[model samples]
Target: MKALKKSIYAEYDVHDAFQKIVLLEMQSYDGTKKQQLKAFLEDMQRSGCISGMISQFIYHADCKKFYIEHLDDLEDIRKEIEDCLGEAVKDRYGLPHYTFMCWLCFEEYCYDIYRNSFE
Candidate 1:
């Protein structure tokens, strides 16, 4: 994990890259956030490419806030997310050891990380 974090840090400034990942993880469980993501995940799981699924999500997230009229500051943040997702997919995948159900369960794990980070 340290190696992965370092590699992502090299590609995107450490602060921005980590922040987005943390933010995504955090919001992933927020009630409203979960509702939004539930819809996306239903569609995403059909793709069957764990890496691509994660990448597309990160891609859309990086670009999401910027689509708002007053959220230009998010553009750079979005770009960084895209870069990380690109790198994560290039090397990683849905953990094959885990069943799809288990993999989906891991999203809750991510939410845990985000929650812990904030505390």
Candidate 2:
């Protein structure tokens, strides 16, 4: 809940180590927030969330800002997305279903991943 700063892979948990590999294999970042975002996008792609190249995720996905800022593991990022979506829906502020865009982005990214699979 506290932004996941306390748990960066949980002291070499195998699954956690694999998560780092997943992100690294997806894109290269200099340990910056951009890396976190790209990693999230890649995770979304694998999980059937959103799709195309990393560029598209950066261009249109509203949730990039949140991921870039949060810098947590995938599961926590996902929980936060759900919580944010609920809050965004409740409030009449920002864009219509503002946080919902994250969900939508995931869907698009998933489609992109599927489409690319055949190529």
Candidate 3:
């Protein structure tokens, strides 16, 4: 598992201060990718990481991708997902090749822009 490129949607960043959107792509296997992704999402819900935050879980079967919108810290959510994937790998669970994209928030974008300009 690895993380892919990051992106930012200005509207979401400005309007939704406490939330973020993420795209996760997983390699398909035996047509069970959706089920596996749902299970992982359930695990996240049960573990209290996404207790009241997750707003959406959309799966695109044709591309084996998921779009998740949640109100949790972006880095924290990414770490949790990576940790779960690591565990799955260790257990030899149907490890689907995966990648994650974390969209930046307004404040984050400002900071990044400032830093880049200075550098």
Q: Which candidate should be chosen as best, given TM-score against the real structure?
A: 2
Select the stronger candidate by lDDT from 1 and 3. Answer: 1
TM-score of each: 0.22, 0.24, 0.21
User: What is the descending lDDT order?
Assistant: 2, 1, 3
What TM-score does model 2 achieve against the real structure? 0.24
Tens-digit lDDT track for model 1 on 1-119?
32223332233242344335434543544455544444433433444334544542334343243234223323343445457568422214443322232233233334333333323
The runs of at least 3 residues in candidate 2 whose Cα sits more than 4 Å from the true structure, single-residue gaps closed, are 1-96
Best by lDDT: 2
Per-residue lDDT tens digits of candidate 3, residues 1-119? 11111223233432243222212322222335444433433334343211322333222221123323333344444444457558421212232222122222222332332233323
Report the candidate with higher TM-score, 1 versus 3.
1
Candidate 2 yields a Cα-based lDDT of 0.40
TM-score of 3: 0.21
Worst 10 residues of 3 by lDDT: 1-10
